[model samples]
Target: MWIFGWKGPSGFSASSTAEEVTQGIDGSALTAIVTGASSGIGVETTRVLALRGVHVVMAVRNADAGQNVKESILKEIPSAKIDVMDLDLSSMASVRKFASQYQSSNLPLNLLINNAGVMASPFMLSQDKIELQFATNHLGHFLLTDLLLETMKRTARESDIEGRIVNVSSEGHRIAYSEGIRFDKINDESGYYTWYAYGQSKLANILHAKELARRLKEEGVEITANSLHPGAIISTNLMRHHGLINTVGQMLGKYFLKNIPQGAATTCYVALNPQVKGVSGEYFLDSNIGNPSAKAKDADLAKKLWDFSCTLTNPK
Candidate 1:
């Protein structure tokens, strides 16, 4: 159970709601693409970003569900510039197609919120024949970012506004395999554990941001890439695969877990807050710069993971 803890340096704590953390931030000129925008914290994050006057593009797997969410948000904020685009983060072809479609629209992208992810499910393979959790959570976003990075860079150069890429990682990153990532054994189901695979995917999220931040910094681009733990977000459909755990969580969630709004606060803060303007490559918790596992900070591991992802997604 999480009590209202001490506020971080950002004057926000685990109890802070998304709207509370982003008060008075006018993002009228900014445009954002939030993956998984139809469900869970993704919905709240999309709602809050739209409330701040940002033109939000909801990148979701289900166009129907996405439109439902968009309509719901419009009831609250009729002026919101929101669009729903179909995006299945579990499929690389779907990612590429969505990116190409987005590029054809000639819309500027000031933010890319890679918020889509799957949790611990039984061992399965993606359409790409890679481990399901790693493929959807890490590789899909990896390819999507690679495809849209040029657009983000151009938008920053033309608009003179810094772009932000927020990767919604989790505290489960600490529970990955002893090696953090299993590069050689990624598809070896014989040795796989569901939760550990999920942790590996989350850890990969942080490392992706780290290495990406480094590259963008080297190029002198006005874009920041950072990752964060959105707190213990157990109330969502993400727990559907965890039978007993899901049951226990629902029964005790009100007392123990952060509510959906509170769970989304960190993502909103990292994406739109002026305080995070120049910050890059850092892991955040409770809307403040927080330390990640040492493995997450291992620059070598970050580079290696970046290379591995490139090989899988780019394939040059």
Candidate 2:
């Protein structure tokens, strides 16, 4: 059994709500983009950020679903500032378009929560003919972050607000293929297992965050990048693609899983907490910095994955 220790200095625990971690914090001047903001932890994250008076852009693939979420937030927090924007992470074209539109809007980006992802799904190719899980979960956010990075840096410089980038990774990152990432054969199906593919994508999320943090520091940028596990959240659409055995496990494991609020707490903590002001490239869990799997902490591998991702996203 996995044991979660004390809540540490944050005074928050695995059961803490996002609102609890962010209590009394004012976010009126900040603007954030939360991908997959339609439902589950994404929606909860968006709602809590909005509650704290942040101007949140709900980046979702489904416009209608995004609108509904927007309406729901506004109904509760009558003064909340929120916008619905269409984003399909599976398509590079869509990612480019979304980034272009947001850049042209002249909005300052203070936070980017790359919260969208796919789980264990049958093997499928994206529009770019790349594996679906890696494409959506890693490459899509990689490209989106790359395109908007300058905007974030400029915003931080002008507003003197610390820019934050949070990648919602999973603990399952440890379960990837023996090689970690299959650079030469991303599309190979001979040994493909749905969970392994999912794990590879998640591991990429961590590596992407770590490398991003290093590069930003090298360039003397104030933007901080970190990744996290939201804990095993129950009843989220993220599990829609789970296999039968996994589905059964989820059902049986429901009692130990986090509800939506608790699941979103760590994200809120990492994104808004003053305690983590200068912290970067760390993996967080249960509202505190925690060590990830040994593989997740391999710096050389992180850099390698960064190079591979850049090549994929920025083909010559």
Candidate 3:
């Protein structure tokens, strides 16, 4: 847990908690949508953001779970404006429905935190016939961001404030397959390996941000897009698929793995920190800029991903 003492240029480190990173920051007028807000780091991220006065919309696959989280937060901060919306990232139909509902509410979107993800799950296909990890982690977010982009742009333009999009990637991105994306073989069951698939999805998260940032910059939009590694928080259900890993983690995790607060720190920092103003298309770790694998930095791959995602998420 001492990933804390080692500070970065941001004067924060892996040990910093979400509340600590966002202290003194007032987000009273901002509105944010955080996916997977019912559990793990997503819960902490939502809580801290609400604490900072941001109107938070919890987009979770489970409405009951999301309501529970919302209630718990409200119990602590009665003034916090929070809403729960059902969203199943693995289903493109659900994403569109959620986006439509959100837009219809006419809520201003200042921050988008793509924090929900599945890790190292056994091979499975989403309702759309896409690989589950890639579908939920990368493609879901891509479409959600695309759908809400107009609102974010309008908010920035009308309010004269910067908009931010944060993608929660992982260090596991460096562990992907030789092709990085496995684009041509995305659903090839015979070739699928759990870790590689998860890595590929995480890598996609970074590339999505890179390509999105580039496009936003070209358009001269005030919105910035970036990705981050939220550290390994062993208590989360992210590793639920691996019985052996969970066993080992229970024994040795508390000694080294990040606690929930630490895991959510970088997210809160990247989302609300004034120090991050104008930065985009970068990878962050421990609340500071960190290097990603060369493959994760490939601009052509990013552009290709953008086009590919467009086809997959296209309504027609």
Q: For candidate 3, write residues 57-134 as lDDT tens digits.
A: 999999999999999999999999999999999999999999999999999999999999999999999999999999
Candidate 2: tens digits of C-alpha lDDT, residues 1-316: 1236356666777878899999999999899999999989999999999999999999999999999999988999999999999999999999999999999999999999999999988989999989999999999999999999999999999999999999999999989998999898899977889888999999999999999999999999999999999987546788786556557756775677677888899899999988879899999988888888888889999999989988998889
- The reply for model 3, stretches above 4 Å from the true place, is 1-4
Would you list the C-alpha lDDT of every candidate in the order shown? 0.94, 0.91, 0.94
Q: How much is 210 displaced in model 1, in angstroms?
A: 0.3
Question: Candidate 1: which pairs clash?
Answer: none
TM-score of every model versus the real structure: 0.98, 0.96, 0.98
Q: List ranges where model 1 is wrong by over 4 Å.
A: 1-4
How does residue 245 of candidate 2 score in lDDT?
54
| Displacement of the residue 270 alpha carbon in candidate 2, Å | 0.6
The segments of candidate 2 whose C-alpha lies over 4 angstroms from its true place after superposition are 1-5, 243-254
